[model samples]
Target: MATPATTAATSAVSVRLDALIAQRLAARALVLAASRKVAADSSGIKTSRFRGRGVDYVESRAYQPGDDIRSMDWRVTARTGRPHTKVFQEERERSVLFVLDHNPSMQFGTRVRFKSVQAARAAALIAWSAVRGGDRVGAVGFGGGVTGEVRPAGGPRGALRCLRSFVEWDALARATQTASPLSEALERTRRLARPGSLVIVATDGFCADAAAQAPLTRLATHCDIKVLMLTDALELAAPPRGRYTFAIGGERRRFEFGDGAHDGAWVEAFRRRRATFVDAARKLGIAVLPVDTRDELARSLALLGLALAARRGAA
Candidate 1:
């Protein structure tokens, strides 16, 4: 696979993601989920969304028609005469609130758009599905802490407001002019998230302490927390490091390009750090999605949604 540097650097970004509009990709399915919000309107169809998008394992029971054997609990099957398998559900329709971090760092992107743009696009898609599924959508914009909350509501109007707040993530952060705080973000999630909801958080992965993850667990007590880690393509694939100099927080530093002996060494180092961050989140049972640019959003979401749905179905 080509890294960001070797691929799509010059791809036309002419298609402006109207941060205001949801791109209607998978609109029909998204709408259908909304239609069956209450009264147990099971589409009789499982999400196909199995990759841990949302799930809670129920005990194994005797296998039945249409049940996928992949989820068979071998131990239970051995003990029971009839073939028994596990069951799982997609948690169900509820409000989804996006906690978007638009600190100064998120505004910088090595490619087509800033991390904030990617965050907005993903959030818009979620809001679209929530609207289509007849669930209320809400947004919490923050830089150093909770900046604003657009209370959850239903319908296209609710989705519009949600998208509007997502677009404002950058504007609000810039207005505050403060660096984001990790621990405080956790606290805010704890305070604001409600029971039985989806909480999607978008942030640059410069966290202070791993212990700050406690709030995520706490929020999980009431809601599902899926993390979107926004990073730059340049950060992922180190370019041929031509001479580069920059000032950071008043300190000026100059760095040299690869001296032949250490070609791509820094690139390896970055990949390790990125992988570590992802692994840590996985250990905590929080599903993490990495976003480097807006265009990648569609492919990623479709893949993720289908995977999660399949899991739900199999279970």
Candidate 2:
């Protein structure tokens, strides 16, 4: 169980680095449980089905005429009285790169936690999962017209580096005035992610426009790309039909939704924007997970694991 201080730390708009690190054990537990479920549900399917060229050997089968001679299994061929060729699954040490967006828009939330904090927690969970699965982990955080990168490395070191950078970048984003386009960050990711790498982008839906889609589509060609769109409840649905006043950045703003027409328009606009983003991602063959501010991070990630398991089983 998390302490009040830990919960408060995690729930804050500017998350504490320690809170992110402390969630490692919980993240590991969630990942382990999810992996077991996937294995049990998939039966013969391998849990790590994300394609790669790793050193793990799967099996050997009778050699075909076109089989590579170098992959010949002399021992198996002799014992079976037939030409056999060794078959190895792609390497499991895949690189997991996180592209995190800490722009000003991510600072809002009306539920359990801020969108920015949720993004950080999600990124942390992913890093921990990748490290436990024997994959390299790294991150690229962009906000306030600046981008910070942590090169991919094996073990827990890379995950820790990414968490630290995330904490620092979140603070910088709040204080800095300049704005950086999410497309620029996607372009940077295109250069950083190698073929067969798993790229996870955690951001608000601000960058899901035409300009950003091109870079993401190109990156998805060779890399296994996933997008986690962090959103608050208010963004998805309008509040009760009533006038509301709020304070933003030390200024007061008023909104009128008492009128049915106004309320409907607000809801429709939000739905349209969300639909566009989802449709674009679908067209490019990318999987987009909607991470709501009200949901538990661990539970949400476990659901993602199951979705991936189902996809792999189908494949």
Candidate 3:
């Protein structure tokens, strides 16, 4: 049984909209590297153009030996009776929209903070990064049969408005009993996100069925999609065999785990569900980042930033 002080502490760290908002400055610093590529691209372009990398058309020129034959300018080549290739420039100012899930499943966490809080922190970091990078920032926060959307806009004002929505929607998530399908929220996002935008989804992988995946696939057709799966250690593996009591909705519930078989099954189920969602997302050409609740949100997001930078470098 947990002592009163321990219970109070747990409750305190559950989810606080104000606390999340207060950490914005620290979060901004942590994700600085993640958006550096976007900032660089927005400022200027490199002399070398990479073909088949979703760049904007620049001009047509005589084909070079090393140029991709597939990019040959058919009309230009026909008119000049010589091979020509298309040149493209990297785009400036990509839009970044966050799709945050604040459902009941994300409201539970046994460690430092609830998954919902971590998701909000991650969203804030990304929002600030987009602002610094000169990309438009926006978000759709959904759960408990409600959805809050912030239109994409540039600079700090846009970032702050998105952060405010995160806080409000997270609070509503805790109080409502109705479940919001992840697919519906994703469809809404797909409708709002423009082509060439980057969509980041922060969720607990709940309700990730074919319906949910369909919208993401549609969104990916014209936008860069990334999924941040938030999870806790307990979800990955069960605790040691023992009887434990948990406080749920102000009521104490006792659960006994004397045998490891049941616990193993539970862990396996979780693993399978996560694997399914990850595999599906990858198939759709979406990047997946798993954020554990035990890890500090700042460090995890920084690492994610580094990964994004590497991906851009490769591109």
Q: Which of the numbered candidates is closest to the native, going by highest TM-score?
A: 2
TM-scores, in order shown? 0.67, 0.78, 0.75
Location of the lowest summed lDDT over 10 successive residues in candidate 2: 46-55
Order candidates by TM-score, high to low.
Answer: 2, 3, 1
User: Of the candidates numbered 2 and 3, which has the greater lDDT value?
Assistant: 2
Candidate 3 clash pair list: none
By lDDT, the best candidate is 2
For model 1, how does the per-residue alpha-carbon lDDT over 72-154 read when each residue is reduced to its tens digit?
Answer: 78898778767887876545556778878766666677677767677777777767766665567888777733377888888
lDDT of 3 by residue, 64-183 (tens): 899877678999999999999987655566678999887788887877778887887778777766666567889998886557889999987888888778767876777784567778
Model 1: CA > 4 A from native: 1-17, 22-92, 144-146, 260-265, 268-279, 307-315
Q: Quote the positional error of residue 130 for candidate 3 in Å.
A: 1.6
Error of 2 at 244 (Å): 1.8
Q: State each candidate's clash count.
A: 15, 4, 0
RMSD of each candidate relative to the true structure: 10.4, 7.2, 6.1
Rank candidates by lDDT, best first. 2, 3, 1
What ranges in model 2 sit over 4 Å off? 1-11, 42-89, 246-252, 306-315
Task: Compute the lDDT for candidate 2.
Answer: 0.78
In model 2, the number of clashes is 4
